[model samples]
Target: MEKNLRLRKNEDYKKVYSRGFRFYNKDFNGLCLDSKNNGPRVGFTITKKYGKANMRNRTRRRLKEIVRLNRDILPNLDIIIVPKKHTYTMDFNSLNDSYLNLIYFMNKRYKRK
Candidate 1:
């Protein structure tokens, strides 16, 4: 992912978590808020309970790639993706589908400009 398209600040994550609209399914959870930037910015979060550092890093990488591939269609928003334990063992295609589904619903529900 590009540096400008990533949510890196602690305050940014906290603001999204505290105030953003949330969506989720069996695979992952997402929080999104209106962005001040020109394009969508994304962040991946995996807790210690999810797994060790290596496992969490792997899951983060997969999610990042999924977002990177579809970044152009995304809205101008700040999004935080929280992957569940199920994501670690899930196939790439399935994970991509899950992400797309989440984004589809989010777009339908939040009519942001």
Candidate 2:
């Protein structure tokens, strides 16, 4: 993903975590906050509990790809994805499916608000 489309600052992530709506699943947590930008911005968080550097990086890449593929469906929001340990074992297709499900759930929840 491009740098411009990423949530970079610590404050940005905190804002989303504290004020945004959240969705959780077996593999990841999704937090979404309304954004001023015209396009969605995303961030990924993977800790040592998931694995070593390489494993965590792999998980981030997979998540990024999933987001890229579904960017059209995502609204103009700041989204933070926090991956669980099981996320490291999921293949790309499974990861994509799970993330999409969360995105759909998020959209539905946001619409109700």
Candidate 3:
């Protein structure tokens, strides 16, 4: 079974969003960052403005699926995905491609030490 990388706390989310580098792609939202030696982790952001509880969780689940599926292609960097309200309508294929592209984009910007 594959594990889902997760952002667990308010501080962690804030650090990734405010301090970590970001990419806002047409189909996805991303924040890529150094882990300061704790290895890679990930987080998801879905606001109530997106919809009710189900909608928010659905966005999160989709993001987690994309990341989990492409784990091997990714580098050792923290990531966060903040879904736009329009994201709920996106199909899995678009989400997958967009997410993988975002990961590749991040990989290009940050070289492992």
Best by TM-score, which number? 1
User: What's the alpha carbon RMSD for model 1?
Assistant: 1.3
As for TM-score, the candidate ahead, 1 or 2, is: 1
Please identify model 1 stretches exceeding 4 Å from their true place.
none
CA lDDT for candidate 1: 0.89
lDDT of 2 by residue, 18-48 (tens): 9988888777788899997777899998878
After the best TM-score superposition of candidate 2, give how far the Cα of residue 26 lies from its true spot, in angstroms. 2.1
Each candidate: RMSD:
1.3, 1.5, 2.4
User: What TM-score does prediction 2 earn?
Assistant: 0.91
Residue-wise C-alpha lDDT for candidate 3, range 68-109, written one tens digit per residue: 777778677778877777878989898788787777788887
Error of 3 at 64 (Å): 1.4
Candidate 3: lDDT over CA atoms? 0.76
In order, the Cα lDDT scores of the candidates are 0.89, 0.85, 0.76
Predicted candidate 1 versus true structure: per-residue lDDT over 1-113, tens digit per residue: 89988999999999999989999878889899999888889998899999899999989898889989988778788998899897899999999999998888788888665
Q: Which stretches of candidate 2 lie over 4 Å from their true place?
A: 111-113
Clashes of 2: 0
Q: Pick the candidate with the highest lDDT.
A: 1
Q: Please give each candidate's TM-score.
A: 0.95, 0.91, 0.84
Q: Residue 72 lDDT in model 3?
A: 76
